[model samples]
Target: MERFIETLMYRSRWLLAPIYLGLSLAVLALGIMFFRELFHLIVEIPTIAEANMVLMVLSLIDLAMVGGLLVMVMMSGYENFVSQLDIAEDEEKLNWLGKMDSSSLKAKIAASIVAISSIHLLKVFMGVKNYDDMQLMWYVLIHMTFVASAFAMGYLDKITKH
Candidate 1:
């Protein structure tokens, strides 16, 4: 009975497989949105102001960053928690595929979030006339919070490693 229970517990890690698959589906959805934005930018180029177009391009960059974050999380999370990925010897492999552990994954996620937040803050600043003073202050505060959190995480990880 003890052996059976251990086997069952070990195999249960497969439960995470579906969640990783779901992230892939989300990537597909984001790709569709990205192309839609690209098409809109091309069609509206003549009518839109230069600043507005820049903001639109920034949105595309934000989406790409998010998609990258998702892929990293899904792949790394699966490898860390579920099981090692089996790949063909002849297939091209990603350099970072099996290297990122949980701690590194967390750091990458934090950095990505800070980057996305910076882009968002820039867009808000570019259109400052649309936001009141309070709104602008809140945006800056929120971005600062992300920066502080990421810094603390890095510091803690460094000290722990030593």
Candidate 2:
């Protein structure tokens, strides 16, 4: 029974294989969405007023953040469960790849969440006239919570490592 359980545990890693492939598909989807947004921005260039242009730029920034999140998940997930990418010493490499274990990945994800939240917060700020004070305060509070959580996690990780 013990031997059988060990084999099952070992084989569980293969389950992650499908998840990684799914993430690849999701990445492709994000690419299509990004390009779709890009085309819209191009078409709306002349018609979009200056104020709306800011909103359009924010949309682009949101897409960029999502893309970054996808890349981080895909690369780190592959390295952690699947296999190390055969990136060479001289090859152009993302600095954070391979170095981020699950713990670091969690922290990075938390930080990214905070960043994306900030972008949203900015949008709210820009549209303050449309938002009630109570709603605006809640958005600020939620963003602060994310920031605090990320900082606490990073501090804890640092302390535990040493």
The best candidate by lDDT is 1
lDDT: worst 10-residue window of model 2 = 50-59
lDDT of 2 at 140: 98
Task: Please give each candidate's TM-score.
Answer: 0.95, 0.89
Per-residue error for 121 in candidate 2, Å, reads 0.9
Clashing pairs in 2: none
Model 1, span 1-162: residue lDDT tens: 999999999999899999998999999999999999999999999899999999999999999999999999998989998988888999988788899999899999999999999999999999999999999999999999999999999999999999
Model 1: CA > 4 A from native: 1-3
Among residues 3 or more apart in sequence or in different chains, the pairs in candidate 1 whose N, CA or C atoms overlap within 3 Å are none
Task: Report the error of model 1 at residue 114, Å.
Answer: 0.3
